[model samples]
Target: MNIILKNIKHISVNEGITINKLEQIIGASKGVLSRAIAKNTDIQTKWLVNIVKNYPQYSCEWLIKNEGEMIKPTGEIFLTKENIEETAINYKDLAESRKETIDSMKKEIMYLEEKIENLKKQNELL
Candidate 1:
């Protein structure tokens, strides 16, 4: 099993939730997680991000790197100086990745719009 999937399973089990329930909570399609878990395949980064967002009690470091305790202590903030620096770097990287995706999507939309315009012109001729 991928380490991330294994950790996710651990989180689900600890929280007394099933994989299907976890999927719903994370806004993933049904079997998205189950199939990945069953096949020991990697899941998308967005799902991982959603899981982190929804389950704040679990440590992102532990989910990604298995470096810390699975469940954070109650009322304890997970951030430290090192974590802050690392998170800043990660945030910048995520921002750049998202920007690239948005740019690609914009290009695709423009192409589709041009195609639609051409089709309309041809229809008018017909």
Candidate 2:
């Protein structure tokens, strides 16, 4: 069997979800995945994306690159409103942190440019 098919089966088994349920979650027609696997044909990327969307606990890296564990070790994902609020706050914090880092880097770049100009002047004098 193709590695992709094997991986898909492995994911289904690991998730304790039947192939039929997987088809429903991914919105693929019944037996479509099985047919692709049996034929050893490549599964389309959109199908993979659907699977990822439906099963966020599964590692997309593993699905795509065959790297990392099939299931992510990250903490549980809850679809509750509290979790959503927390996630939004976390994202805002991350955006602020990244903006600060970019500003610092811009300052450093200006400092470096000034030093380079000074060095150029010294070289010209010599």
Off by over 4 Å in 1: 77-126
Could you tell me which residue pairs clash in candidate 1? Answer: none
Query: Considering summed lDDT, which 10 consecutive residues are worst modelled in model 2?
Result: 86-95
Cα-based RMSD of candidate 1 = 11.2
TM-score per candidate, chains pooled? 0.58, 0.56
Q: Which stretches of candidate 2 lie over 4 Å from their true place?
A: 75-126
Among these predicted structures, which one has the highest TM-score?
A: 1
lDDT of each: 0.82, 0.74
Steric clash pairs (candidate 2): none
CA lDDT for candidate 2: 0.74
Worst 10 residues of 1 by lDDT: 86-95
